[model samples]
Target: MPTTFRQHRKQDDPVLTVDFTRFPLAPGDRVLDLGCGAGRHAFECYRRGAQVVALDQNGEEIREVAKWFAAMKEAGEAPAGATATAMEGDALNLPFPDESFDVVIISEVMEHIPDDKGVLAEMVRVLKPGGRIAITVPRYGPEKVCWALSDAYHEVEGGHIRIYKADELLGKIRQAGLRPYGTHHAHALHSPYWWLKCAFGVDNDKALPVRAYHKLLVWDIMKKPALTRVAEQLLNPVVGKSFVAYATKPHLPKAQA
Candidate 1:
């Protein structure tokens, strides 16, 4: 997530990283959307009949998320038995009992936090044994390009602090006592948008190139044109903006008498 004007808008559709097909969300599952920036995943989980909790440190985002969840409920968007909650909280110190959640998702958030492993440990602690986790981070290559292009892209407070290579992140997941089952990349078409932003200026969304690229991204996301979709699929492995990994908290072994 680059420090851009894009962060301010309420995304009509979630900018998804974890594919639902791979990390399935069952009905009534207790899901924690840790560091849920704009409650995108939380809203999806709610629509899927899960008991969803969207937690973030930013109270403003939390309030807006809560409103959206409420609106969804009033509009009958969430199915019967699906519940959603938005709360302001810290990722490093989750305010939940041990084994509290059936699923946890932290998307495009760890890179902003300094103690990435500490956040992982907390997520592992709250997740029930055999529960699944979906973790997403900015891919190193594209992120490095943004950094090289402009300092303002990531130098600000609450901006991305580090990029994660696939192996390095997988190793951390293992260290956190989770067994990684699957991994993938997403938002391949969105990478160039940030590169343009960095080259022009992180805040200069008005730049002609930036404006043009932004429209292209908005078109792809909202309209989902077949051409761009196919192009994204082809390019994801090589230059996806986000790296997604799915893992499970291992159940402890039984002891012999």
Candidate 2:
């Protein structure tokens, strides 16, 4: 049985919605997990048989993720021939060369960086032609509620600098010369939870409603059943908290004479 968020709220987690396995990650594909805070999606890529480069700006998170990758490697948890390495790097200026990675995952990351355009450029630069990139950010509506409730929510260090609307984000990606392909929302049940937190205080753990909602979300993530599935699916298009946009690097040739 595959582990869900509930069973293990570990640093390395498999997010069901992103569906990393669906990507065409063969044995030798190079995958980059940009802004990989704790190697959650990066570990998933490694487990799914891709060579993963987990990059993060936070030194501590990078250290922890590196440890987990080493541990996973020793334990033989990663797919045969799959490997991962965590590196401390800035998203705006990726340390890798152009066309270095076949796939790039940037989940819940762009919102935190100020120069998101620079980051997107770096993502597009490192990705090989015809490679795919997946980016996730807080959906507009839910993020607006949080912003309206508390300026402090976005003011702190490592906090979200901006909330991205679906079209705006995709447009920026397209401007960087990538072709947007598919988009979806995720974590539908968790929106109200953040709303409650923002209503009370972004850091207020004493709020009963927030605590209760958090537990419920944890429960839902852990024990996936028919009811939650239907509810999440129905709610996703309406009130999902995170928006995921997938795009591919354009590979079309110039018009010939």
Candidate 3:
């Protein structure tokens, strides 16, 4: 993985918050981490005893994630029956049959794709009726700040093409034939860090303020200090960096006799 990707994976809380109780994940559940960059959430699902398939278009990332999956299995980090596989595949044309997976997670990815609706349609196609899906994107307000602060933040190749308002995203999910039931924001504490990077320069890692904030974030993720934890919960609702929406594919209605 690239240094920046590793840093974010290590520091950033899992954006979709894969709490099984809320997300309808069960042991042996077939889970697809669509756009599973670096496979953080995919590995988590494996550890929770799910059969996970981590798919991404980046071949190198897929290889690295596969290596990690093997290492996790060898090290016994994952549960006894859990399994994982990684593959390089396009998000818009997922290589799976309809209703193949029970859970799907796409995080911080839609903003990068030009045909987001097509991707959502693919997700819906692969999910079994009543299966759960989680979609996350950079929230409008904070993402707008980053875009305003530095064109470099979004103007690059494969960078975020648009910011998503919460309602707009949920609306798209509903349009895809999924019934949205829950929504929340996350990574509240990491918002300012991006703003600072955007303000200074995305590559200015040597800047004192950015470096300091990075350390603080790393510490918070590693140590989970109560003060920072509570602070993040309080801030998440107001300025959380990512908007997460959860929905389920609706089961077909019973035919009248």
Candidate 4:
């Protein structure tokens, strides 16, 4: 869904946009990672002992994820009751039945699709009552800067089609019949790296500044030293690159006779 430099989640530990501390997961909970590019979040959920289904329209990525899941299972990376599945499926039409999942996550996926509301509706439909959902997108300010700097950044197919402000996204969640409880920004440090990419060329990873920034991000994600962690936390509220929101589906009232 996201064709940005942030898609470089190839590390042993995936760089997750959702903070599990806030959106907690338990063992055996049914979890879905819609638009699960590279199976980053799905891998994390598997490790956390959830029954995970990583779905994506990209058949190639789905195959790769399935391989990794098998490897994890064989290696005992996932705990005793944790099952994992990776399948190619459309976000607009999920194959699961109603009230099928305890948690649903769609990160960096909504902006690429034209019918954002349709995607939200599908998420609401599949999530069980009281089940949680996390949605993340490119934040408005940083995304606007990238748009201003480079048309090539968002003009390509499967690139980000729209940047969303926090309130706007939360409102859509409410409209989808989910009650949003909390929200925050993430990846403040990576914003500038993307900005640099936009200024240079989205595909030109060989550029000097882009290459330099790429090293810094890999180091930050891998080692996660105190300095960058603290810096990202402090800067997140202001210039963070991605906006994350957590919501839960509510039970319906009884019908009148």
The numbered model that scores best in lDDT is: 4
Ranking of models by TM-score? 1, 4, 3, 2
User: Could you tell me the TM-score of candidate 3?
Assistant: 0.93
In model 2, the Cα lDDT at residue 7 comes to 35
Better of 1 and 3 by TM-score: 1
Q: On residues 79-124, what C-alpha lDDT tens digit does candidate 3 reach at each position?
A: 8778899999999999999999999999899999999999999999
Off by over 4 Å in 4: 1-14
lDDT of candidate 1 at residue 1, scale 0 to 100: 23
Reference-based lDDT, residue 158, model 1: 92
lDDT of 4 by residue, 82-190 (tens): 9999999989999999999999999999999999999999998899998999999999999999999999999998998998988899999999999999999998998
1-257 per-residue lDDT for model 2 (tens digits):
12433233342252444655445567768999988886778877887789999999899999988877776776667778887889999898889999999999998888988889999989999999999999899999999998999888889988998888899998999999999888888878888888898889988988999888877776666566679878888999999989988889988798899
What lDDT is reached at residue 127 by model 1? 99
lDDT of 1 by residue, 1-257 (tens): 22221332235453677799899999999999999978888888888999999999999999988987887877677899999999999999999999999999999999999999999999999999999999999998999999999999999999988888899999999999999999999999889999999999999989999999998887767676789889988999999999999999999998877
lDDT of 2 at 55: 94
Q: Estimate each model's TM-score.
A: 0.94, 0.91, 0.93, 0.94
Worst 10 residues of 3 by lDDT: 7-16
- Order of quality (lDDT): 4, 1, 3, 2
Could you tell me the TM-score of candidate 4? 0.94
